[model samples]
Target: VEMMENVSKYRYANVPNLDAQVVEIPYADGRLSMVMMLPNREGLHSLQTLFRDLSYSPLASTLASLRETELLLQIPKFSIESKLNLRPTLEALGIKDIFGFDANLSGILAGKSAQIGSVLHDAKIEVNEQGTVAAAVTGISVIPLMGSTMDTFRADRPFLFAIVDQSTGSMIFAGRVVQPTWAAPSPLG
Candidate 1:
């Protein structure tokens, strides 16, 4: 709570598009970026279900249509550490032998049969008032409010995000924040 109190708050335009609202923060050199996707209160479930479809066209479209509005940005400060066991998920996708006894990796190791014992993916992220605690460049934009009346975009609930390489437009990291926190970060985060 003390950390949250000192966060540098900003008021900008918060445009609402189709299913979710978005904000893109580019890296200092424009070679990397972070994109935040906050879904409508009612669209959370649908967004989660659709996130796995590599072609995030719907998300792209919504971002391209942003029109800036009033926003009270106060994303809570949090850190996440997670591990994912990919053996099961991979096998289900038809990637079997690598984790089975029948695996054949002899070319790399002449006489030894090398089979993957386990596949573990570990990731960590921290976001606070200063910015994302990541090992890359990312940029941010502040859109001024157009009129006296303004809308707010506060990320106090579940939201999705991605860290991408702008040069190649490849996602380096992606996940959701179902319950943003330091101690109990969600796997989605």
Candidate 2:
């Protein structure tokens, strides 16, 4: 057919096509992961950009408002395993709600955190050994908890993001986002 011929021609000419496979990984730990196989970096970048825009755009506000009432009506019941089991320490820390599971919260958090770091960087405030701004302080100062110092020390460093193969539990990709998009566009551009 003409369409098949055109597609073959385009493929031979190295023209990009919108053909990618998305794999969903479900964990026994109640976490869901997604892996998208894109043809090139451009496709990945565009997808990321679209996700960012959808998350922070005014349209999200309207959609969120519509869903807020429905969400509020549903009281999440904690499972026995969730209450009594002591795995995934972060979950035990009252972070039961997985906000970044979707593009909305993930993009917003990435953007906002990047923005915070940018503002701090712009201010040029000196960071202490514990990664705290020289003049800035938090409740940890008044908490007087024994493990608080350890937590603060651990939080003083940058974090990395990684993608792992669900079946094999092997790391497929690892990288760090130095600056959030809200803080600045990519330096490569």
Query: How many pairs of residues in model 1 come into backbone collision?
Result: 8
Clash pairs of candidate 1? 12-71, 13-69, 14-69, 25-139, 26-138, 26-139, 27-138, 27-139
Q: Best-fitting candidate, measured by TM-score?
A: 1
TM accuracy, model 2: 0.17
lDDT tens digits, residue span 44-161, model 1: 5746743643264654454455554334344556577889999899999999988888888888778997899888999987675355522222234343456734344446667778
Report clash pairs, candidate 2.
none
- TM-scores, all models, native as reference: 0.62, 0.17
Query: What C-alpha lDDT values do all the predictions have?
Result: 0.56, 0.24
Query: For each candidate, C-alpha RMSD in Å?
Result: 6.9, 26.5
